[model samples]
Target: MESEELLGNLGQEENGVPKKEKKSPLISLEKDLTFYADSIKEVAVEIMMEGISLHPIFIAHQHEVSIGEVILNKADLNTDWTIQASTLEEFIQKGIIHPDKKEQFLKTYKKPENYMCVFVVVPQGANFVYYPYPKEK
Candidate 1:
């Protein structure tokens, strides 16, 4: 997908009028994720090899990042699409894992060995989604 198509909307209001519906960051970036699935899976595997079992890769199409190891980025494009590889421990230290949701996160967390956990973040909200490797082909 073109960089403009990726970063153009961003859920921001256009011409001072709100969009009828704002697209979730995850939905907006689905194509990008699919396009980079192989690279994403490779990074997830590498993170697992590093001994961190519950790693989450954060995806956002904006700047001002200060966490996670950047596995994929397009800074040169001026579109600012980026994906950062992070671990459960790092999230806890950064307070991204709220104390109340810690138990829930752990209880419902999927195994990294079987799936790549993507922590999709947007201006509206964030969510954790899992994807299978090799696309089950």
Candidate 2:
């Protein structure tokens, strides 16, 4: 049987609704990481806008890559003083992010000349604040 046909058969059910495959543990973990990453970004941006200096830590992932596959085995956030760095190499040397994703992370998170798009972790229960970064030149 062709691959597409075989896959269709695997998902078929008597009621005609395709049966969804169970998510692997790794996928579940990736989803969790994505959720946390978003939360951290939101909080970090807020903190950044309040005139408070932040050194937030983050595990940057490529936008083209599914978050469900990005590994976070070594990411460690300080929560208290995490600051956004300009390069993946900084995080990699600190052991806060995995080195294996260096290429994709750099490609997705930074602009040319090493300008970084901010993403960072913050302490839980931080007061909500609205501060936006000025448009990049």
Q: Provide the overall lDDT of each model, using Cα atoms, as 2-decimal numbers.
A: 0.64, 0.36
Best by TM-score: 1
Score every model by TM-score. 0.68, 0.27
lDDT of 2 at 60: 36
Candidate 2 residues 44-108, lDDT tens each?
A: 45545664423333433222211111223334642212223223344455443468866665455
> C-alpha displacement of 58 in model 1, angstroms?
3.2
* Local distance difference test, candidate 2: 0.36
RMSD values, in order shown: 6.5, 15.0
Q: Candidate 1 versus the native: TM-score?
A: 0.68
Which candidate tops lDDT?
1
